[model samples]
Target: MTCSPPAAPGPPEPPEDAAVTTETVTEPVSTPRERRGWYFYDWAASAYNTTVTTVFLGPYLTSIAEKAAGCAEEGQTCADLHPLGIPVAPGSFFAYALSLSVFAQVLVLPIVGAYADRSWHKKRLLAWLTAFGAGTTLAMLFVTGDRYLLGGALLVVSNILFGAAETVYYSYLPQISDPDERDAVSSRGWAIGYLGGGLLLLFNVIAVLAGDSLGWSTAEIARWSIVSAGAWWAVFAVYAIRPLRDRPPVETSRSRSVFYAFNQLGRTLRELGSLRLTLFFLIAYLVYNDGIQTVITLSATYATEELKLEQTALVPTILMIQFLAFGGALLLGAVARRIGAWKAVLASLVLWAVVLVAAYFVPARAPLQFVALGAAIGLVLGGSQALSRSLFSQLIPAGKEAEYYGIYQISDRGTSWLGPLLFGLAYQLTDSYRISIVSLIVFFVVGFFLLLAVPMRRAILAAGNEPPRLL
Candidate 1:
């Protein structure tokens, strides 16, 4: 999702010998069309976030691995398989695959962000990754019975691109919204995403629920769902690629060499101490966002393995989360206007802690309880995430929004790998998803106190922006 505005026509530059010069000028306010176009990518990208990442792919891929490993039926005990000489419970395959994808992102995305900030073609870069990722997602239709490796490989590549593109997408936030308007704009994008994700998920849920009567196997239905998400992502992405303006490189001369980009990055790293308050906030966000993301990525898997919910119940339960998340994001944005975005975020984090504790005790046989848990989670999911990005924007230096956002994106998507990896390891050791989930509470607890301690006014002033108006 490219949030930066397109280059509008400017008055022609004066000839070198002309006595007068014209300065390139930009509109002070974003037009409605530009705002809508900015929101489109979030709307489009959410399909994959919901259908492939959050709901279907992990559980479905695990089933494929289980079948390949000769496991049959629910309640049958399957021996741990070591496909690559490493012990792996059948349930852990998809989670581990997710962790692997995050690991790749942690290594690649920083450089990608640095380069994207220096490239004149942010729109093209965003489009290339979107198409590449979406194509890989569509290829999941071919990952049948014993093709777990193909599924895993495709997921790794697509998910990495997803994170990489997001680095560019998120950096555009400050470019579009004024400080006072950012929370609302970011929340709107998130809410729109949930709406789009929910619509596609609604279709997938129906397909899964009706598969038996239609003479299609459950696996067949899931593969189709994955492909649909890709189609949704590709089709909606065009709105962003075509309408939103492309930004010139943040620093034109910096774009001249690959080494120059990293050289600048090295200088930024050396200056981290000057931005220590923002550093504190980043750490706090890193921990808590990890918990939030871990729950999101693995919720369906947890419900399937621990709650024993059927696909019919599980998929619809996820659909419920999607709708609720849309409302929740918008609600928090409104509430943040009254209570301050920082306090609103703190409130959401507390609710997250409540959700984790409540999830641990939800009885496996009670389908209604699982549905309720999904609702509670949806309420805080988008609120916390949307606000976090906006709040971080306030702390970044002017003219270096994209450069600093590279580090912020590192916290956003780069940190995603650690949570899944830790979650996977916990499951590998305990074979209890309940225990693994509850362990994530430590991150939330730590992040809360750290956030409470950050000097907001100081951070804003340090970044050379006025302190945000809480009301």
Candidate 2:
């Protein structure tokens, strides 16, 4: 995700020499070839999400950190490793790395959007970021033994690069598709991404299962698995960017200030003050999405600590969600085409509320019930998110899509902490994970009402964007 585009006036045109070196069009035109390319980028990027972040990195990094702390096993309790004279727990290494990466994204992504919006070669920028990000992931292959600090640094850098590339990639949606077709396009991208990520993860799972038989150490297998994802990302991205077209910058002037993106980001936030509907939608999205992400981030913990499920069982559940989510994105996209994106998102929120309630009542040590709950989550997960992106695309100013999406990224991609904070507080008070899990209803209920109040067409027009036919 990225920042929302600004509707405020742009700077005057710069000299021809300052112009970006790319073919320019009068306005963005949607084409089937370009759309397919855009979809493949998602497919490429999701490998990082599924393989590195979701499946491999946490345990691998923790194992490295444990080694650094003189522990024999990954999950062993040991003294904190003091890197650069700062104490850090081995178990928390991955979490701390994730936090640091998200912090970097929050600071940099808006500026990335600002520069991207001003450039004619946005696809080129996307390709460069993808390469750099993949390179960082590839470097993970060398993060062996007790190099926990190096592993943590790579994770942070790769994650930031991942977010930056994603921000640029998302900025393409408005330029590549019509307003009404956005739901379908975004949904297809997400579905393809899920498939790609799931396929790689499935392969890795098989590899992990056969590691002992193949006479490979778990560490070696993990290293190869991690690097394979990077290879997959780099290889697939070439095809993704090949067909994407270049669109002319709305504002041709290049800001010379070293603080241009920062300055522009400040201006963008100020501009959002007047775009009430867009702001309202952003607020609603932030609140509810925090809940959705918290559910995703904490689900494994719930299954382990509360349900007492084994790690082996959780792997299959995660795979189930990944594969099913592909269908879910398409399913909700069809619903969006029938009704409207906004309404479809609203309906998904209702379903989210119900899912939380069901989670609260699920029996402890019930694997079948837990599997059923996972299925429910998988069905609603991709649909809600895909529709949210499509719906927000309609609410931002046309020329500033990347910029606004940078702002949007501040809360998107599991960055927001409010929901998790609330969950933690609830658990701390009552020692009941179930109560904490269900407590997220505040976000959904409030978001649903906030969304209800948004006048979609009015917001689109106010943002200087054309309203979708259904909206």
Candidate 3:
């Protein structure tokens, strides 16, 4: 972690945002210890993303669901499981579970954020959510045999908890860092997350590869890997939350009223009209981030099905991307310091567009070409996302950070469905993964043009925030 002398003792003067909220303004003092704690939280949480969400749970869940559907073996194609008289494909079970989780997050996280903002116990809320989420994840160890229903329920609950926790977690960004420090701080957090997640994934990969020799079955390996992630998250989060101190509540009134929080949530939604540039930026983020997420989600499938790359090649590529992305996040932050976060994000978008186009042309049976494409993807992935978060933090009203971020998180989670839908449609029509992959370009193109129309400095000022030093 970067070191600095202690922050000057005393609250700084409130900014223009004080006029926008009814709460007493307690100016935040950014400190190295708090920032380090914040970074560790990112590190602690990312194991869920890398190990369970991205790597293991989907296929493992599918296999269990297949067995429940009466498949003779895990790898064989099986009949759909009919739940409540509705036929559900085993292959799509994890996808559906993820969708359900995101849906739950859409309904719940705004209220979570709103309550967090009003309460004096933000740190406690984060801790509770993390513990519960980790507990649910750890429960996967008991989802043995054909207990597909239990697995699905646990996955949904855990994922929703993760998103809710993340909303509370992200609210800390604006509170812990000044405008000028946000980009670098956010970037470093993402980089550390990549490092933490990568190291665990590497260990899991080694365990999986050595499973047969170690007398462990594939199922055993997957189960242990998942539980390891939960343990890692729970263990690391202790240190992550320790050095952090809670801010003064945004308001002491309505501290006990969910209805009041929801009303404030509605007001926040209506207030977006006046924060036009912030709204526009959210729209742009929703579109482009969908494309980015779709690409990340579909890469393994495309490489395996389209290019016929084996797990031997595919797994290593994922590991490479994870590690490289650490440096990539830092590289983007450094670039942001020189050229500003806005331009840096735009540049990353252009890179994303290029990566997709290049993916469309990758030759069949070409592992080398696929690995090279993944390297390019690794370079832009975390950088673009980290910078986007920092940039959006600069565009929201100060005391209302959690309220505005509630909307931002909703957009982040809720809008990712479109790109995948479009991708599926393209593949259905063309019978080609290449065509399906390129179809996502529409998202980036439209988002880029929409973002160009946004006046960044004006939006920051309009939100009653001073523009960041670089911007």
Q: Give each model a TM-score.
A: 0.91, 0.85, 0.88
lDDT of 2 by residue, 255-289 (tens): 73427767888888899999989999999998898
lDDT of model 2, residue 285: 92
Output the lDDT of residue 246, model 3.
70
lDDT of each: 0.80, 0.80, 0.79
Q: On residues 1-471, what C-alpha lDDT tens digit does candidate 3 reach at each position? A: 111111222245443333323233325575788889999998998888777876677667767887898884635666778766767766556556666666676767788888888777788989999999999999999999999989989988888788788888888888877789889889999999989988898998888788778898877887888899899999999999888777665444635578888877787788888788899999999889888877876676577557767555776787788888999999999999999999999999999999999998999888899889989988998999899999999897766677767667753522255665676556545768788899899999998988878899999999878787776
Clashing pairs in 1: 5-245, 6-245, 6-246
Winner on TM-score (1 vs 2):
1
- Clashes in model 3: which pairs? none
Per-residue lDDT of candidate 1, residues 277-359 (tens digit): 88888888888888888889888889888888888898999899999999999999999999889999999989999999999
Error of 2 at 167 (Å): 0.9
Tell me the deviation in Å of residue 163 in model 1.
0.8
The regions of model 3 sitting more than 4 angstroms off are 1-28, 69-78, 304-308, 363-365, 411-415, 420-436
Q: Rank the candidates by TM-score, best first.
A: 1, 3, 2
For residue 332, give model 3's deviation from the true position in Å: 0.8
